[model samples]
Target: MMKPLPLDKVYRFIEPGPVVLVTTAQGKERPNVMAMSYHMVVDDGDPPLIACMLGPWDYSYRAFRATGECVIAVPTVDLAAKVVAIGNCSGADTDKFETFGLTPLPAKMVKAPLIGECLANFECRIKDDRPVENYNMFILEVVAAWVDPERKERRVIHHRGNGTFVVDGRVLDIRKKMTKWPTYIRD
Candidate 1:
C-alpha cells in the first residue's frame, strides 16, 4: 500500500532537472540573467523548442515577455556559486554581468548575450506566450546553439528548491536495453 503525496509541491521530490541561466535583452536595454530551473525540451527535432517558466514577479519576466528573445546558458557545476548569486538578486536593481564578472558573448540570432563560460548556449525566440497568462510558461524556438568544443563532459547543477542542489553524476547507459532511436542531428 502507498500513501498519498502532496501534489502542490511534487517538484521537491521530482528534482526538476538542471538549472540554466536565462539571459534576456532588448535593443538599448540592459541585459538580464535569471537562474532558472523551470525549463524543459518541447521537441528534439528540427526547429527544436523549449519551455521555461518565469513567475510574473521575477524582474526579468517583463523583459522576456516584451522582447521574446533570450539565451539559455547551460552552466556546469563549476559555476554553481555564480548561479546562486545571480538567482539571489534582482536584475532590475543589479547589473548581474558586472557583479558576477561573467563574460557576455554576442549571440548569433538574438539581442541577448550568451555566457561564455557555460557548457552550452541556446539562442531562442519565443514562439508562444499564452501560458505566461495562465501557467507562466514561455514556449521558445531555439534559433542557434553553441557548445564548448574543448570540454569533454560538463556537469550541471540541479535544484530541488529550498537550499538543496544536485550535481550531475555518473553515466547511465540503458540504450542497449531500449529500442534504438534514430540519431538526432542538429542543423
Candidate 2:
C-alpha cells in the first residue's frame, strides 16, 4: 500500500543530522547563538569540513561574515526544549546566552566561545564561501573541537521539520557486519 507525501514534508524524511547550536562573535560585541539543523559533514578526515547554511536573516550570520568563524556545539536530548526555543527567537534583541542559561567557555583557536553544556563543540573557520551568494551555504574547517566527558546523556535531538522532534535511542553496534571498513571499527 503506497501513500502520498506532501512536498513540503519531504524535509522530515531527509533530515540532515542532529540539531546544533552555532555560536558566533565579532570584535567586542556579545556572542550570539542560533539553533541549526541544516548542516552536513562534507569531509570526515583530519580537520573535517562541514557545510552549513546561514543567511542575512540570521543575526549570527553577520558575525560569521565579519569574523569568518563560529562554534558548532552539539547538544544532547537534555537540551532539546531550549534548543527549539532558541531557534524560535532572534538573537538581535535577546542575549541568547543569558536567556538560555548556557555557559560560554573560551575557545582555543577562535574568538567564538565554546558551549559548556553541549556534548561536543567544534570551533570552525570559513573555508569556502562561493556558495554563499546563491545558496547561503559556507564550507567550514574545524580548527578545534571540545567535548564534555562527564555528561551521561549522549542522545541527540533531531528536528522533524515542524514543532515535533525525535530523540536518539539505543545504539546497535554491528562492527562485525562491516568487513570492508575494518579500520573504522572500534573495540
Candidate with maximal lDDT: 2
Worst 10 residues of 1 by lDDT: 178-187
Query: What TM-score, computed on C-alpha atoms, does each candidate reach?
Result: 0.92, 0.96
Segments in model 2 whose C-alpha atoms lie over 4 Å from true places: none
Candidate 1 residue-pair clash tally: 0
Kindly provide the TM-score of model 2 when superposed on the true structure, using C-alpha atoms: 0.96
For each candidate in turn, give its C-alpha RMSD to the true structure in angstroms. Answer: 2.2, 1.2
Model 1, C-alpha of 139: deviation from truth (Å): 0.6
Candidate 2 CA-lDDT value: 0.93
Cα lDDT over the full model 1? 0.87
**Candidate models: Cα lDDT each:** 0.87, 0.93
Highest-TM-score candidate = 2
Candidate 1's residue-wise lDDT over 1-91, tens digit each?
A: 9889888768877756688999989668789899999888999877999988988788888888788889999988888999999999998
lDDT for each residue of candidate 2 in 68-109, tens digit (9 for 90 to 100): 999999999989999988998988899999999999999999
